[model samples]
Target: MLARMLVLRFPKEVVDKPIVTNLVRNYNLSFNILKAHIFPRKEGLMVMELRGNRKDYERGLKYLKDIGVKVESIGQGIRRDDEKCYQCGACTAVCPTGALHIERPEMEVVFESERCSACELCVKTCPARAMIVMFDKAVELEEELA
Candidate 1:
């Protein structure tokens, strides 16, 4: 199985269409929408995790592009700077995915990257500024796709 986080931008002309539904029915892909903002007759933006077989995934992406959806990979990921973290547990409170949590018995903050959804809540809630967003990969991928 192949899974990727994607940011999709829809032009105003295609904003009202059932783009996601088509992906599921026609492309045989599954998606988990992390965020979306769409208004009728206006441009739309969505952040989602799309999962499928490698071939089907590629086909789905092509379909999106053919329909005027600008698809971008969320090549970026979150990293924790242990040097900057004070283990104060401030980030744990806002982490919706349990990516940042205090370990039992030790009372130390642990960061589980696999569970992270790149929501950035830990980055915002951390008083010590420990959580960092890495953007280099995203920039490279965007440039290559463009």
Candidate 2:
């Protein structure tokens, strides 16, 4: 099976359509929506993880593109600033994927970027503003990390 974190941008014209539903019904894909802001008659943005077989996943991507959904890989969109963090663990409380968690023995917060779904919960919950959301600069941030 192939599972990937994706950032989907739906244009206003197609925002009301059942685009994601078609991916499940026609392409045999399953999705876990981490975050979404959809406005009827306006644009929509969603962060989700789509899982399915390799061939089905490819077909689903094509289908989304054909229908005018802009798709992008969720590449290093969230980062934790160790210098600014005080190990408060507030981010861990709201992190749905457990990407941000406290280390048992050391009592320190650990950020696992790979496990993060780009949900932005940690960014909002971090009291120290250590969790940074870099959606617009995601590609550049990925390059910097590499």
Candidate 3:
């Protein structure tokens, strides 16, 4: 499954009257949304996670752009890292969408990509920083630098 995380900034008038419900109703692709309170308080930040075929995803982006929302950043093809995770539940607690969960028996962490709202709280909260977020390309982190 291909997934993308995008941060959108909206104009004041549009932000005050968010068209979330309308977008959800219109889009055929599945999506999760998260709102962040940033400076210029009313401006608002919207994080969207889209899942489906490439064509559907592209169509969704165009629809959002048509609504006057500015795309701040776009990350693609992200997947969770189960092996590096310890089921600590820290990520789950921080996740606004409840996308991460600690499952028993295997004592591993599970991720529902479709449920991820792209808030990025889990990424910041993870002690191990094991949760991998991939864009169009993979990132190389040097442990020595840390």
Name the lDDT value of residue 92 in candidate 3: 78
RMSD of each: 4.3, 5.1, 6.7
Q: Per-residue lDDT of 56-117 in model 3, one digit per residue for the tens? A: 66776787788787875565433667667766878878877668887778866789887765
lDDT of 1 by residue, 24-140 (tens): 999899998866778899888887889999999999999999999999897758999999999999999988889888999999999999988876668778889989877654444
For model 1 the TM-score comes to 0.81
Whole-model lDDT values for every prediction: 0.85, 0.84, 0.64
1 versus 3: better TM-score goes to: 1
CA lDDT, candidate 3, residue 118: 51
| Index of the highest-TM-score prediction | 1
TM for candidate 3 is 0.53
State model 1's lDDT: 0.85
- Tell me the deviation in Å of residue 7 in model 2: 2.8
Q: How well is each residue in 1-146 modelled by candidate 2, as lDDT tens digits?
A: 99988878889999988888999999999999876778899877877889999999999999989889999886546888899999989998998888888999999899998888887778767879998886774544334323
Which model is ahead, 1 or 3, in terms of lDDT?
Answer: 1
Off by over 4 Å in 3: 38-41, 52-57, 76-89, 92-119, 127-146
TM-score of 2: 0.77
What TM-scores do the predictions have?
Answer: 0.81, 0.77, 0.53
